[model samples]
Target: MRIRKKRSLLNQAAGGDGLRRVVRKAYGVFRREGLAGIKTRIAWLRAGAPGTVDPRRYGEWVRCFDQIDDATRAVIRERVANFENPPRISVVMPVYNPNPQWLAQAIESIRAQLYPHWELCIADDVSTDPAIRPLLDRHASADARIKVAFREKNGHISAASNTALGLATGAWVALFDHDDVLPEHALYCVADAIQRNPEIRMIYSDEDKIDESGKRREPYFKCDWNPDLFLSQNMFSHLGVFQKDLLDEVGGFREGYEGSQDYDLALRCAERAGGGAIHHIPRVLYHWRVHAESTASGTDAKPYAVVAGERALNDHLDRTGIRGTAEFELNGYRVRYALPDPAPLVSLIIPTRNEPELVRECIKSIVDKTTYRNFEIIVVDSGSGDPATLGSIASLEHDEVVRVLRDDRPFNFSAWCNSAIEASNGDIVGLIDNGIEVITPGWLSEMVSIALQPGVGAVGAKVLYPNDTVQHAGFALGLLGMAGRVHHHLPRGSFGYFGRASLRCTVSAVSAACMIVRKSVYRDTAGLNEKDTSMAFSDVDFCIRVREAGYRNVWTPYAELYHHESATRRDDSDLAMQARFDKEVQYMRTRWGSLLRDDPFYSPNLTFDEENFGLAWPPRVGALV
Candidate 1:
C-alpha cells in the first residue's frame, strides 16, 4: 500500500511538470503569433483535456497569453534595429527654458536613434538657463549629428524652428520639440516610408506620451493620418517629416502660431499637396514628453497654445480661400464660421421608410431645439408599409413647417436623401436619419457655425447611442474591414488612445445620419451615389467626392444627437446585409485606395468587435448606459 501511494505522488508531480511545459510552450506560440495563436493553443489543450480543463478557465489562460504576447511585441519593436542606408533627416527642435536634464535626455534619445544618417538641429530661443550652453556644447562635441544654434535675442519657438529650418540640408525635415523624444526608429521609419512612397511629400507617424521620468505613459493618438482632420486638429504628433522642398514651398512654419507652429505647417502642406499622397505610418514612432513645463500639461502654461491652434485654423481657412468666420464665441468657447447669417433658411431633410414615431420625434426636435428658426422639415418617404405613418404626418398641426416627398423606385438611403435635398428650398441643407434625436438646444446653430466656416464644405454632428455613449464622432476611410464599422460608441468625452477626441475629428467621410451640407456642395458632388442603392457606405462616397471638389468635411461635437442606429429599419436577413456591406467596402477600397489606406483617422487599434458592438457588458454599463 505504501509503494502504491508513493507511485501515485510521483505521477502527480510529473503531471504538474508537464502542465508547466505546456503553458510555457503555449506562451511562446502566443508571443510569435498573437491572439490567433493563443486561440489555437486553447483548442489544442481543450481537445486533450475534455472535462479536465473548464472552457472558462481555458479562456482566461488564453487572455493571459495574449497580454504577454502584446507586451513582448511592444518591447521587440522598441528595441528593433532600423533600416540599412538610413536616409539623412534633419530634426529641427526648438527650445526655450526647458528642464536641463530632461532636455539633455531628449537630445540623447535622438542620438540613440538606430538611423545614423540624421542630424539634430537644436535652435535655442535665448533660453534663460545659464547651464544650457555648456550642456548643448557637451552633447554636440560627443556626436557630430548634434548642432546647437542659439539666438542672442528671444525670438520664440516659431523663429527658432525657422532658424533650424534654414540650416536643414537633409532630404527630409522632421520637426520636434526640445522636450520631446524621437523613438529610436523614428528617423529610420520616416526614411523607409519616404523611400517606399516617393510621391508622398510628407509622412506622419503615431506618437506616445512620456512623463518627466521619460517613462512611456500611454499612446496619445493611434489612428492613421488624415488630411481633412489635419485641418481641424494637429493629428500628427512628433510633428511630421516633410520633404525639404515642400517645407520651403510653404515658407517653413508661420510665425504667429507660436505654440502650434507645426500644425500651421501641416495644414499649409496639405493644401499644397491637394489630396492624396500624404502618408501616415501607423506605428508609434515619436514620444512626446509630458512634464509640468509641457504646454499641454497645464492650462495656464499653454493659453497661447489654444490661441495658436485657432490662428493656424484661421490661416488654413484664409489660405484655402475657405469662406468662414473665426473666433465666433458660443457657450463660452469660440466657434468659427464662414457664413455671415445664422438664419439662412436651412432645409432639414429626413429620408425614411416606415418610422412614423421617429420622424415625429426628429421633426419635433428640430422645431423645439433649433436656435435658428428659419428651417423647414422635409420628409422623403421611400415606401412605408404602415399607413399610420402617413396618418401621423397628416395629423401634424404645422403643415407649413413639414413637406413630404415620395420615391417609389427602391429603398435606397442615398437616393432618398438626394430626393429630399432636391425638393428642399434652402441653400443650407441638413440630413437627419429617421432614428436620430437631437440633444443640443442650439444644435443647428453649432452645425451651421462650422458648415459656414470658410473651408468647410460638409459638417456632421456628434452622434451618441440612445444610451448616451458615442456612436459616431467622425468618419474615416479604410476602416471598412477590420474596423469596417462606422459610428463607434466611445467613452463620453474620452479623447481616444491618441489625444484624439473621442468627441471631434475631421474625416474624409461622415454618416448621413446627421449631416449638414451647403447647397452648392451638394449639387457639385452630384448628390449621393445613386448606384449604391442599398444601405452601406454611400455617405462615405459622397463625402469623398465633396473632398475631391476642394472642400473640407468636418465633424463637430457641438452639434450632439442620439442615434438609435438603424432602429427604424431592421435587417431581418443578416447574410444579405453582410453581402451588401462587403460589396460597398470593396467598392470604396478600389476607388479611394489612397484615402482608405493612408487616412490617419482610420485607427487600426480599433478592431471589428471593439468598434461595432463596443466594449463588452459590465464595465461598459457605466459609460454606455
Candidate 2:
C-alpha cells in the first residue's frame, strides 16, 4: 500500500503516461469502492482527514461475477428445479435500434438463466435498422422458448411493451430492456421469491449500470415496496416482474407515456398488488447498459423522458384521487398536493416556558413566513413565572390566530402536547419546538398537504442545524436503543443514501419537533405517554403507535426548518434527567420492542450504528419462521 501511494505521488509529479497511470489506478479504486470510496480517496489525496479507501468486502456487489462459480450455479439450478410450483416467467423485450452486440448480450442473458421455466418474448418496434429484425429472427428460430413479434407500424416503447406483454403465455412477466443484461441466477432468484411468498404479485430486484466496456457500476440498493419512495420516483425500473393477471388488470402500459411507460405500469400494478403483495430481492439481478443514447448515461439523452415521467406521476395522482400536481425536479417527480376545499385549520401547538425572546421569534416566523393561511398558534405555556414571558404570552392573546394555554403542572412534554391537542379546534395538530426557525416558505402548507393524505398519520419536516447540517430527516428505529434521526448531520443538499434525505418518503417515525399529525389519529393512539416519556422517545413512541394503527408516517425535505437545539450539547449532569432518559429508553424498548429492532422503510442492509446509509458490516438476515 505504501509503495503504491509513493508510486501514485511519483506519477502525479510526472506528465502524460504517469498521470494516465495514476488516473487509471484511481478509476480502478472508483470501480471497486463506488462513489463513496472515490470521495474518500479524493479527500485523502487533498491532505484531508483519515478517511481512506474502505477495506474491500469478501463478497461485495462488484465481485458478483466471481461469486457465481460453478458450485453456486449448480446450487441455484438444483434449488430452482426442485421448487414445487415453478411459475413460468415470460421475459418481455421491446426492441429498437439497439447496438447489435449489446442486444445479443441481452438476449444471451435470458438464454443463460439457471431457471429453465421461462420464455423470451420479443417485439420489434418497427426499427429502421435492418440488422435488428434479422438478428432477432435468427435468435428466435434457434431457440424454441424465444418468440418474436414484428410490429406493422412504428409504435413507441409503450405500444411495443404492450405488444410484447400480449405475446406472454406465462404466469408472470419480467421486463427486460433491449440493451440490458440479466444475471444467470436472476430468474431463479425471482422464482425462489415467488415460491417463498405465493401471494407476491409483483417482484423487483436491485440493479447496477454497465457501461459500454461492460463494467458494472452505480449499484442501487433499494428498499422493499416503499410506496412513498415509489411516488417520489420509479425506484423499480429494472428486473421488474409482475403477475400476468396484475398486468392484464392495469392494461399493460399506457400508449402516450413512452419514456416512463414502465413507471406508469408499475404504479398501476402496485395499486392493485398492494404493498404486501410486492417482493424485493436484494440482489443485483439486472445490469442496465449505459451508452451515449441511453437514459442511464444521462436524462439529457431523452429530455422527453422527464416530461413523460412527470405526466405519468400526475396521471397516477389523479387516477388515485390524490389532489396533487407532480412536477419534474431533481431527476424525479415532486408532488405538491393541492390544499383541501375550505382548508382545515391547523393548530400549531408549541410548548415553551420563560423563553420570551425565543417564543417571540418563533411566533414572528409563523405569522410572517407561513404561506398557509388557515392556522392557529396554540402556545402551551409551562408555568412561565418570568414577567417578560408572561407579557409575551399576553401580547399574543390580542391576535385571533394566537391562543395561550397555561399549564402550571409538572413540565411533561408529552402531557403538554396531549393537552394542546385536546384544546385544539383544528383537525390537524403540529407539535413544534420553541427553538425551531422556519427556513422554507410553504412549510406548513407542505406538511398539511401530506398530513391530509388518506393513510398518512404523521408528517415531519427536514430539520437542519444552525450550521446547515441535518438535525433530523425522519427518525429511524434501533439506532440508539430506541431511535435516532435519519441523516442526522449530513450537509445540506447532499442527498444522503440514494436521495433519501431529500425525498418525501415513509418512515417508522418522525420527530415531534416540527411534526404534524391528524387530531383523530392522535386520539386513536391515545396520544403520547406523558408519564413514561415526558422528555425523550415520546415522539418516537407516538409515531410508532400511529403506524401500528395502520397509517404511514412521512418525512418531507420540502418543508425545511432550522432546529436551534444541539443534541451534542445535551446536559446529562442532572441525575434525575439521566434517570428519566434511561427510563424513557427502557419504556420505548418495552412498548415497541420489535419495531425498534426493525424499521421497514429503512432497509436492514443499511447500518444503524451510523446515520449515513453505509453498508452494514455483517448484514442481518431473517431466520426461517
Candidate 3:
C-alpha cells in the first residue's frame, strides 16, 4: 500500500509531457525494489526531488533574470568597458566523442561570450567520430582565442584535462565541458568575481539542465562557499574557475576519476582555499546538456561516477587527516567522522516543566539507546507543579547518570540552559528539549564527533516529529523573521533539495532542542542569550554568535531523534508571551541588521517567505550586471 501510494505520488509528480518515459520506468522500480528504490529511482528520473515548486518555475525565473534584452546587453557592454586590467581566463575543455550538435554549441557559446579576454583551450582525446576533428579545426580557424589539440593517444578525461591545462597561458583557468553550453555572461561573471575579489582562488556559479530541445530546467541556484556541503557533493562543478597558481599547487585533476575528475580537483583546491578564497556566484552560468548518456540526465548513465566520487571524497578525507569513513548514499556522500580516542564526557541538559511522559521518553530513550558511553544527564526542572511530573522527577533523582536541578524561575529557557551549563563539567554540552526522544542509538556518537571538531561550533541532529516527519533538519536566518525550520515536514529518509536534509552540512543555525557543542564554545559565546531573547530566538542568536566567532554550525541527518514536543502547535496565546515573541523578532532585526537578510548558507535567489528553497517571486538579486 505504501509502495502504491509512493508510485502514485511519483506518477503525479512525473507530470508534463517530458517525464512520461520516466513514469514508465518508475513502475519497474516499484515492482523490483519497493518504496525506497522507487523513491531514489524517481529522484534520478526527475533529476531532483519534486519540491513544492511549479515545474515551469525555473523557465520563468530564467526568462526574468537570465534572458538579456538589447538594453541590458548595452549596459553589460558599458560595464565591461569600465573594467580594470582583466586577467586572461583560459576556458579549458576536454573533448572525447561528444555529440556533433552539442560540441558545436559548446564552442559557439565560448565564442559568443560578452567578455573578450577568455581563450578556449580544447584537447580532443582521440575522438573516433570522423567529423570531430574538422569541427574543432573550423572553430580554431574561426577564432584565434579558440585553441585545439588532437591527442595522439586515447587518454581519458583527466589526462585530456591536464593536456588542455598545459596549453593554458592565462592566470585563471575555467573548467568547461565539451558538450555543456555557457551563457554569454558566463566568463563575464567569472571575470567580475575575480576582479572584485583579487585574492579569490576559486569561483563557481549555479547551473541548470538543458534537454535536447534546448529548453532549460532544474536550475540549481546554490549558496556561497560551503566547505562541508562540498564534501558531500561537488557543488562547485559548473562554471568552476580556479586561479592557475592554486591548480599548479594542487597538481590539477587526478587520473581514474574521469566522471568526477572535476569533483576531485575541487576537493584538492579546497584544502588550500585559505578560509575565504572560494566564491559562489548565484546565477545559472552553465547549462548541462541532458541526454540519454549525459550524467545530467541521471547518475546511472555512469555508475563509475558514483564510485569515483566516493573514492575521491575518501582520498580528500585521508589527505585532510580527518578520521572519518566516506560512503556514497542517495547520490551524495555521508562522512562519519570517528569519535576521538577516550571520547570526552558529554553533559546532556534537558529543561522540562509539567510534561512527565515526554520527559521520561526523552530520558529513557537516551539511557537505553545512546551508544556514546561517557555521558551524564542533567534535568533542569523549572517549577513542575503536577504531582505525577514531580513523582517522575523524584524517581530520576536516584539514577546515577542523571541529576536534577530545581529552578523555580519564570519559564526562561535560556536561563535554565545556562544554569545547567554552569553546573555541568563535561567537555561537550548537549541542549536537549524534554520532548526530544532518541530515534537512533548512535545519535550521541554522531553529534559528539562533530562537536569535537576544532572549527565546528554546534552540531544538530535530524529532528523528526512523532509521525516521522522532519521537524527541523536545520535552521536558517531570515526565515519567518528569526529562525526558520529547514526541510520542515519532509518524510524520513527523503533527500530534500540536493540532500539539504540528509547531508551533514553547515547551516546558519540548528534547533537547541537537540544541539551539542563543546563547553569551551558555549563559554566563548557566553552561552544563550537571556536578556533580549530570554525565551524565543535564543538558540538562533546563540548560533549566530557561534558562527561570528569563526566556527561552523553543522546539521547532520545521521543523528536522528524524535522531537515529541508540539512545536508546530505551540499555543502562545497569552498576551505576554505574544508580546515577548514580537520583541525577539524585532531584536534580531536590529541586532543582526544585514546578516539576517544575507544568510551565506542560503541563496539570495531563494525565498524567505518559507524555508523550502522556493523561488522568490522577485528574486533578491539585482538586475544583470
**lDDT against the true structure, each candidate:** 0.66, 0.79, 0.83
> lDDT tens string, model 2, 511-546?
888899889998999998888878877888888889
Give the 10-residue window scoring lowest on summed lDDT in candidate 3: 9-18
Instruction: Sort every candidate by lDDT, greatest first.
Output: 3, 2, 1
Q: lDDT of candidate 1 vs native? A: 0.66
Candidate 2 residue 200 C-alpha distance from true site, Å = 2.0
Candidate topping TM-score:
3
Greater-TM-score candidate between 2 and 3: 3
lDDT of 3 by residue, 307-344 (tens): 67878999988988999988665557778788878999
Tens-digit per-residue lDDT, 1-625, candidate 1: 1223323323343344535544564565455445644553343323221112233543453254212344544553443334444468998888888888888878988887656778889888888889888889899899988888888888878898998887788888988887788766566567767766779988887665677665554443345554444544567646488888899898997777876788778878878885576787755677777776675453234545655666777777787677654431111123345445546889988877767787788787778766578888888777776788777765653568888876776557777888788888998998888777866666787787677665677888878787756677666555544224344655444433332333345666677788998898899889888775356667778888897898878877657688865554437477876777777767767787767655545544333344442212221111100
TM-score of each: 0.71, 0.87, 0.91
TM-score of 1: 0.71
User: After superposition, which runs of candidate 3 have C-alpha atoms over 4 Å from their true positions?
Assistant: 1-48, 566-571
Candidate 2 lDDT (Cα, whole model)? 0.79
Indicate the worst ten consecutive residues by lDDT in candidate 1.
Answer: 616-625
Candidate 2 lDDT trough over 10 residues, lowest sum: 46-55
